[model samples]
Target: MKLTFWGAARTTTGSFHLLETRGKRIALDCGLFQGRRSEFFERNRDFPCPPADVHATLLSHAHIDHCGNLPNFVAQGFEGNVFGTNATMDLARTLLLDSAYIQEKDTQFVNKIRARKDEPPVNPLYTVEDVEPCLDLFVEIGYYRTFCFAEGFCGRFIEAGHILGSAQVQLDVEQASGAQHRLVFSGDIGRAGRDILRDPEIPGEAQTLIMECTYGNRPTEPIEGLREELRDLVTRVADRGGKIIIPAFSVGRTQDLVYQLSLLFREGALPQIPIYVDSPLSANVTEIFRNHPECFDRETRDLLRKEHNPFGFETLTYIRDVEESKALNELKEPAVIISASGMCEAGRILHHLRNSIHDPKNCVLIVGFQAEHTLGRRIVEKRPKVRIFGEEHPLRAEVKVLNGFSAHADRDELRDYAFRVQTRSGGMLERIFLVHGEKEAGEDLASYLREALGVEVHFPERGDTFEL
Candidate 1:
């Protein structure tokens, strides 16, 4: 068998990996790369391999960075079954359609500016028309059920604990020489004790492991302190009659924040202030979350049994119509508004940031990883000015980041997970490959694994390929 690093290879955004065996190719993920605009378009618009040649595609989760480019892949002529868990298939349906809509909208926005500057208009990577066919190719596989891709190949999906329907893939291959091997792909490992989702399932055994190291260099704040920190921030903003604007991802991060806030409100720890989820995509994704109680953790399931609707309350409102979303800008009272496109790059979050970021009384909260060169990074860096929708905006809002809300596992947790896999495999886990992280993060984790776990690790670059 052969493996190729197509994306997320020394960087965190695009996550494509190609595996070849028995004259056929399989892609683990085909995610959109997010970064500098020119590079993002060039990378996401094209696939390194001919899409038609691929036999199958297995999706790990529905996050845009992991499953965002499926439409583009299918548009390029790949005609194979896309396998995922039932929840993953359902969530991916919404996420991919939303992604396509965003692409078309963002392209129109950029084209208008380009036309004004006498530059050629760029095309959207994929559109809603392209997403429908991709959805038709989706096939649902239940967790722990093994499915055959070819005569000598089969795999199982283990609970990954990152988001609803996320899974760690385990592939078993039978070589022509009658030798057998197990390969595991750790798709965005989640925190063990994070709220709402269960802890990552233990990877039973494997010979070769490909894992993500998104937080390899950063240690998260104590989980116990997350609620108190959030409560204090919200309380301060409300006391000053100011808005709290949060840039969160629609899938996991947004739901996590809503769940935490619900807990605080139920316990009377937080003041009664109106809370709005401003993105239509988030509202849709939350509905998907409601349908998948099997994905919930013990705590969340308990809450669901009692409250029936853990994501709703008297003060909580989900904004779907554009008029309602725009009305949020007109409100003068204190409120907490959570918006999507977490990097502050797109969606209603841009409008919310533009309207509220200039006020010293207002606060902007960042609750997820901010890749380099993103608007979120600029805010985290406390830049004096930021450009939104091609206009300069003052950055006077108090910018606060809480690392405790992150879904990815930190350095120590990753090390522990690797050790557990190693121990469980009884030294059969010979090769470990780290992907889905920045250069520094991959390097740091590589050193830690080499020194602490004494495992042979490799950090593959984009376009790098290895035969095993």
Candidate 2:
């Protein structure tokens, strides 16, 4: 078998990997690369391998960075099944269409400027029309159920606990010599004992393991402190009649905040401030969350059993109409507004930040990873001024970043997971390929794994390939 690190290698985002076994090629993920505009366009505009030659794609979850580029792949002539959990397929439909819309809107915005300057107009990576074909290819498989995609190949999905329908992918291949090898890919392992989702399943034995090291260099703050900190921040902003703007991803992070806030309001810890989820994508994703009760953790299921909708309450409103979203800025009273595009990239979050950041009493709460050069990172750094809608605005709003609400496992947790997999493998785990992290985080995990378990770890650079 041949394994190739095509996309996410030394950097986070753009999680594409390739596997060739038994004369068949499989694409692991066709995720969009997020970064500088030019690199993002060039990398996602084309596939490293020929699309038609790939027999199938095995998706891990519906996160944009992991599944956003599938449409482009399909548009490029890939006619193969994209297999994932049932919920993943459903969420992917919503998220991929949203991603396509964003790409089209952003490209139009850029092209308008380019037209004035007499520069070449750029096209979107893919359009909504491209999304349907990709959705048609999705094959929903239940967790722990084994299926064969081709002759001499079989695969199964394990609960990953990252988000709804997240799974760890296991693939087995039988060679012409009748020898078999097992390969496991950890798709962004989630933190154990977190709210909403179940704990990540213990990985079984495998001859080769590909895992993410997104939070390998740091330990997450305790979850208990998250609610208290949020309450204090909300109270401070509300006391002064200001809004709290949260730029969250529409799918996982938005749902998480809603559930946590529902708990707070239920306990009377938070005031009766109107909480508006002001993103159309968020409203749709929240509905999907409700539709998939099977993905909920025990605590969330318990809350549901007690006649409470964990994602909703009397004080919460999901705003889908653009006019309704715009009306939120007119209100002078204190409220909590959660918007989409978690990194403060392109979305309604930009409008919310523009309107609220100039107010001294307003608070901009960041609750997710902010990639370098992103507006969210700038806000997290407390920059004096930020550019919104191509205009500069003073950043007088208080800024608060909470890491405890992150879904990814932290340093110690990742180490423990690796150790457990090693022990369960009983020394059969031959090679560990660490991906989905920056250079520093990947290096840190490599050193830790080498020193702790005496395992051979490889931090393959992008485009590097190896024979297994």
Candidate 3:
């Protein structure tokens, strides 16, 4: 079998991997590459190999970075099945449509500037019309139910605990020579004791392991006592009569914050301050979350059993209308506004940042990882000035990073996960390849895994290939 690292090789975004065996080529994850504008367009538009040549794609989750480019992939002539969990399929329908809308709008805005410069207009990667055909190709499978997706490969999805329907992929491949191999892909491993989803499940055994190292070198703060911290922070900002702007992902992080806030409010630990979720996609995704109780953790399920809505509260309002979103700018009272495009690359969060970032009394709360070159990263770095909508704005808002809320596993948790996998493999594991991380993070993880597991570890770069 031959495996190639197409995307997310040494970076955190765009997770595409190609596996060739038994005269069939399969894609692991077809994700959009997120980065600088020029690189982003070129990388996402051009595939390393012809999309039509791929027989199938196994999706890990509904996050844009993991499954965002499926519409483009299908539009490029991939006619094979797209496999994912039921909730993943449902979430992808909403996310991909939203992504297409963003693409069209962003291209229109970019073309306006290029037209003034006499440059030729460029098209969006994919349009809303491109999404329907892709959506029709999805085949949903329940967790742990193994099924053959191609001639020689049978795969299963294990609970990944990352998002509502996230999963770890396990493939059992039979070569033409009648020899069998087991390959496990750790698809964005999540923390063990999170409140919303179940802990990541470990596959029994596998010879080849492809894992993520997003937080390989960084240790995240514990989730314990984060409620009190949030309460204190909110109280401080409210006392100052300043708004607290939070840039969160629409799917997982936003729901997490809402649930925590609900708990705080129920306990009467937080002051009564109005909170607004200012993204239409988030409102839809939250409804999807409500429908999928099988994906919820024990605590969340128990809460639901009591007829309590952990995602809703009296003071919290979900805004869907553009006019309502615009009216938020007119509010003078202190409030909490949670908006999406978590990296602040796009969406209503940009407008919120542009309007409130200049006020020192306000706070910008970062609840997720920010990739390099993104506005969220600049805010985390506390850059003096940031450009929003082609205009520079002073970044004076107090920036706070709450790592405790991160869904990805930390350094110690990753090590423990690797150790468990090795132990389950019963010393038959051959090699480990680290992907979905930056250079330093992958290096740190490689060194630690080698010393700890006494096994071969490789950090593959983009387009690197290996035969097994």
Better-scoring candidate (lDDT), 1 or 2 = 1
Q: List, residue by residue over 168-236, the lDDT tens digit for candidate 1.
A: 999998876768989999999998888888889878679999999999887888788899999999999
Q: lDDT (CA) for every model shown?
A: 0.89, 0.87, 0.91
What lDDT tens digits, residue by residue, belong to model 2 across residues 1-468?
899998878877889999987778998878888876668778887676789999999998988889999998888889999999988999999999988887787778778867888989888888999898888899999889999999988999998988888999999988667789889999889888889898899778888899999888988787887888888888888988889999998888888899889878988999778999988886677778877888888888887789777778899999889799889879889999998898887878888898889988999998888876678888999999987755689999999889988888889998999999999999899889999988888999999999998978999998899998
Write one digit per residue (lDDT tens) for candidate 3, span 1-468: 999998999999999999998779999988988878779878897777899999999999999999999998998999999999999999999999998888887788778877888989998888999999999899999989999977779999999999999999999999878899999998899998899899998876889999999999999999898889999999999999999999998999999999999988989987788999998997789889988998988988998899988889999999988899989998889999999888998788887888899999999999999988788888999999998755699999999999999999999998888999999999988889999999898999999999999999999999999997
**Model 1 misplacement above 4 A:** 115-119
User: lDDT of model 1 at residue 73?
Assistant: 86
Number of clashes found in candidate 3: 0
User: Positional deviation of 457 in candidate 2, in angstroms?
Assistant: 0.5
Which clashing pairs does model 1 show?
A: none
| Model 3: worst 10 consecutive residues (lDDT sum) | 105-114
Candidate 3 error regions (>4 Å): 111-122
In the order shown, what is each candidate's alpha-carbon RMSD? 1.4, 1.7, 1.3
Measured by TM-score, the strongest candidate is: 3
**Clash counts for all predictions:** 0, 0, 0
List of clashing residue pairs for candidate 2: none
